[model samples]
Target chain A: MTTGAYPSQSTARLTRERFRAGECRPTAGIAPGMTQTNLIALPRDWAWDFLLYAQRNPQACPVLEVTDPGDWHTGLAEGADLRTDLPRYRVWRDGVLAEEINDASACWEVHPDLVTFLIGCSFTFENALLEAGIEVRHITDNTNVPMYRTHLPCHPAGRLQGEVVVSMRPLPAAHIARASTITARYPGVHGAPIHVGDPKALGIVDLDRPDFGDPVRIEPGEIPVFWACGVTPQVAVMASNVPFALTHAPGHMFITDVPDSRYHV
Target chain B: MTTGAYPSQSTARLTRERFRAGECRPTAGIAPGMTQTNLIALPRDWAWDFLLYAQRNPQACPVLEVTDPGDWHTGLAEGADLRTDLPRYRVWRDGVLAEEINDASACWEVHPDLVTFLIGCSFTFENALLEAGIEVRHITDNTNVPMYRTHLPCHPAGRLQGEVVVSMRPLPAAHIARASTITARYPGVHGAPIHVGDPKALGIVDLDRPDFGDPVRIEPGEIPVFWACGVTPQVAVMASNVPFALTHAPGHMFITDVPDSRYHV
Candidate 1:
């Protein structure tokens, strides 16, 4: 999906070139500052349910926009073309695992329509926290925000329903409060801590080993603050077991033209 | 639902008491220091569409919290009961005015299956504007903010769709800019101006004749700044012609515990 001509590679150009060359993988942290979104290329039949899914599960699915079918450019975010701008895409078949692909054109269909969802990513507020002199444990440890599947069920939208997934961060009590307050302002980025203390309360049994991502050390007085993770859509996608679906692998996010600051609640 | 309480009585208490007393009237001037919310209550059947609608049309529908069905306490705001708190409710059936009621208890069904939307109001920012020494035209004139139906189509949400409605205020260019920059920080209150200068650009034919609210004077050298208004939900709710719906009257709003300052984007 990223292949393109690079007359002169700039930050955006080089980044696009890398994606175009297939040199960039799903997890590449190539660019920063710009907003990153979640991708959901589903059949036209399922687009409505998926959109409802995002709306019902806002913390995990704070949608930036849904592009007009097959029209990939997100005018909200610097006219970035969703089809080719993204590093990669996945094809899901009726809730079943399907072949992973780089472009949709090969598998694109008018009836099995695809919708693009731009979700709020923590990367925006993670930057805000770091700039605010607050430490981001995940970045400090060079690990993904430890995500755990929770007992908290997402509000259902047709067949797209599943348990809420959350990412946890450990911080001192004061910083936890500060982070909660600072982050809550950006509703675009999951807005505040859903749970601030015991992981077991959210039904997770262990902190050292998460369902996804590496766990960081929790210092003496630090407590955990959990936020709804973007992985929620994948959970919903999986729960639906639709014949087809698409999502970015793990940390691979769809970069958007919207500035991180634009997501304030 | 207005039963068990004195209608129109001050309730000899605070916002909650007055509201609980079937004072479901204009919340515009109640609870001065407290935050007031705009309401959009829809049946659960249409929940996803309206939720998606709010998400797509944030400048106009910046959600404070989309409540979990049957459970009304926002847990974020003043923790007022969703079903009983607002002094009044307007029921829209099949896209037409059906009836105005004091409480939605008669309309309430368990699962009662419904979705409630809380939106930030201009009042929060108006206080800030007043404190900054800027004269709020509507407040000075003792009238609703001049609102008009714009040519802009609100990003559609299923069948739930309509044109964008903008509230306008005529102020000096410097004040308008400062107001934009200031309100730009408060995305909760419809954020900054969507358009400035020629109202026609937004498909507004006459600034003196508004679709809703009293028109304010536009002095020489003053420009009209238009912002996405909370009235948007009313337009969508009506335009969509959903089987059932509810919303607050113009200016009247639900007071919340959230401080206006907390909404700084």
Candidate 2:
């Protein structure tokens, strides 16, 4: 999912251009310096609920940009068409996955009043973690990060309500603090780890079995750290049985022109 | 508007209790350690525009908490009724001031689907400034902080559109940086000064005659520092000619049970 090339701004544009030209791939490493976001497009009627939900649970759903209803442009990415710029998209009908596609133009035609939200993805902080000398287990293994559903309830907003879903990365006990301090600088991304050292604490029984993405190797001296994942809004959409929705496929995020440093506090 | 005597958590609760019983006074000094907020309630249909407007112009309209439609309870204050707890309220009808009153319960009866938004106020950070030994001019003068509607345009969201509004404070040139650094820690509370030194830069011709609140003396060797003010949203509501709205009367803000330190980043 990561190229580790650390593309420049122009390169970031080129990556999105390629995606617009029908190339599909995970966006983590392609634009390391630029920001990558989790995409969620909800109907105009459901927009308020999702926006309020994100506002309430900022740690899990830090909104980078929310497009006006029926608008596909975001200020974060210049000259980028959100409908076509993402490498892959998932269209949902009545809370269930309808189909996975490379372009969402057809979905917009069916639901023109969709309001798109570009939420901060934790992948934005992975470069900082790696630079701080901490191993992001999923990136190190060249695989999608492990994620789990938890019992933690997010503050309900209007029609949207669901439990928090968290992504896991096993860090050596010594590097845990450094990893936290590094990621905490970017609250626009998922800030620091929510819990560390116990899977039971988050109500997970097995380390190897993840609800989404592939499981990674957890070394003996490593502690499992959990972060509020961007997938939370999708979980909420599903739980609420939203009539129609669209989201970026897991690990295949929307790469923006905004530099990761812009979100740094 | 400031009391200088920083109160504890219990005093904060007592203060709200008094307001709930119809005590009408500015909330500054009554709960110095607790958070203060700017209240704006709009009909459910207009809620999306205002929420998106706040999200886009965070510096001027930092949202603390937003209530569900027709709901008056805020999680920021436990058991505090939004309709009755505040000292005063301004009822707006078709973008004009319809009336000013001590309680908004009657107004809610007419507009049952109003969604209330609690916004961050600069008063929440004034205590921190004073504790750091920086003299806050408005607090020193016992006046409402002077606010101005700037020529700077806010990023429009849906139907809401207006310019940035700023609160000004004159500080000794040496203390300007310290004041900025101090307030920058509380992003939820308007964060830092948007401008310094020149009032002309913000299109203000006179310092003595402020558009809102009272003017403070700018001493020799002192420079005027400007911060994004909570009034920006009211300005937007007026500019957009919103059919109906409710806001706390200027200087008479809603005091929350949450500590001022809780907003510190």
Candidate 3:
């Protein structure tokens, strides 16, 4: 449900309650002003490599918080249990999708060496962009943000190595500078746009057919702006072929207690 | 040797040459415009906890780069061997000071699981402050910057936990604003001052005495400015009492290839 229908704090509580009860749905447009996070849980043996990967490629994987081995609670939210806080989760085994589940507690219990990482999501900055009078077309159209795989190679860390993945938002040519300036303040999120124009330069042959998410129309005089997507790490993790890994489904995020403004410089 | 005697680039190379040749000395003012880093090497088993500790307490441990397991080469400095590039090293065993040596290669070789971490140093921001017309009393007086053990406890991660340590710089009341603004741009370093005017606010009793480093004179009109020190991670790592750890001796840092200006927003 959209945050407009409920009070901000109660909306977040309601979202968590729904998720805990196995109500599987996307988390977009929920808990306005509250930060949402991309979740990744890996075995303790593989966590250090992923942490190092995030450190090396911060633009793509801006970590908000990380839990100790086998811990599910994060300081980012009060009484938020990571095992059941997200609306949906993607379980991977040997770099392949094993199953989609609403509750990951069973999987987590089996692998007691799991460590959770709360990574900053672009949705936090989208809220700021909306407040600044910049239109986030996906939110306006009530659809998933368009994302594409780029040729830009991320710096390799241990066994985690892959090309960067980015989300696209088409904006008017005039709003490009203001949008970048506004988002640059929130480096805790994905930060500013990585590319302003020419998807071809990023090795994306077709803007209308995205590798992930629904493609949005680019009207006359509007340019597609690309920001590093949280998917980059997920893709890298999958490519690394770890024995088992879990991540929040696309558009299905873990809502955090941290305000969006906290990330603003 | 001070950087005033050679060109900036040559000075960095010269400093590294001397360090590699076993010229044991403090690195302050040796490469004026270049960035210097605090080094910490820990076994792979403990590296995850240390990485988590650094992530939780980024202000105190702004990690510049973390090497893979048993790796010592860092991209921060080209051909700068982490094993011998630093003028001095402190070997810790069971959290106690084991020995001070000019080289840590032998120690690292013995513990093949060692992973090196290069953390940002305040010397980079100090250079920025000096360029902005702020006086760094320690550099002017040719003494080590004053550091103190504050009552501010760091957010614990895994087995690592300790009080936050701060390096004090006395700035004129009028320059505090500018110094903070300038340093805030460089979050790679300690970012802005954590505390501004009063020493007692941070549980620091006397300005003339410090827990580490030589105390500097706090002038009559100067306000004591405190920035989170890199020594904090070392303190926490020591307190964790890991089997073996290695860190750079105070003021004897690893000279990085990155320029100070790169960190500026």
Top candidate, metric DockQ:
3
Q: Give the per-residue lDDT of model 1 (tens digit) for B1-265.
A: 1222332223213666667677655554444444567888877677667766887788888877676665576744444676667776778888887786766676666337677788877766776777777788777767777889987988897778898888887888878878877777788778888988889899888888998767888789899988888888888877877777778666667777665666764
Model 1 alpha-carbon miss at residue B104, Å: 9.0
Q: Provide a comma-separated list of chain B TM-scores, one per candidate.
A: 0.85, 0.94, 0.94
- Report the C-alpha displacement of residue B182, candidate 1, in angstroms: 6.2
For model 3, how does the per-residue alpha-carbon lDDT over A1-265 read when each residue is reduced to its tens digit? 1223324666787889889998976666778788899999999888888999999988899888998889899887778899998999989899888998999999777899898889988988887788878888888887887889899998888888988899999999999999999887777788888999989999999999988778897789999999998888778876788788999987789987767766766
Chain B TM-score of candidate number 2? 0.94
> Model 3, range B11-113, lDDT digits (tens) per residue?
7777888988989876767788888899899988888888888999888998889988888888876677889989999898998889999988897779888
By TM-score, who's the top model here? 2
Sliding window of 10 residues with minimal summed lDDT for model 2 chain B: B1-10
- lDDT order of candidates, best first? 2, 3, 1
Query: 1 or 2, which is superior by TM-score?
Result: 2
- B1-265 per-residue lDDT for model 2 (tens digits): 1224345666776877888788987666566778999999999989999999999988889898998899999888777899988888888888888898888898789999999999999999989988989998877777777888899999999888999989898999899889999898787899889999899999998989888878888888988899998888888878989999999987788888788977776
Better of 1 and 2 by lDDT: 2
Q: How many clashes does the backbone of model 1 have? A: 18
Model 2 DockQ reads 0.50
TM-score of each: 0.70, 0.94, 0.93
Native contact recovery (fnat) for each candidate is: 0.26, 0.22, 0.48
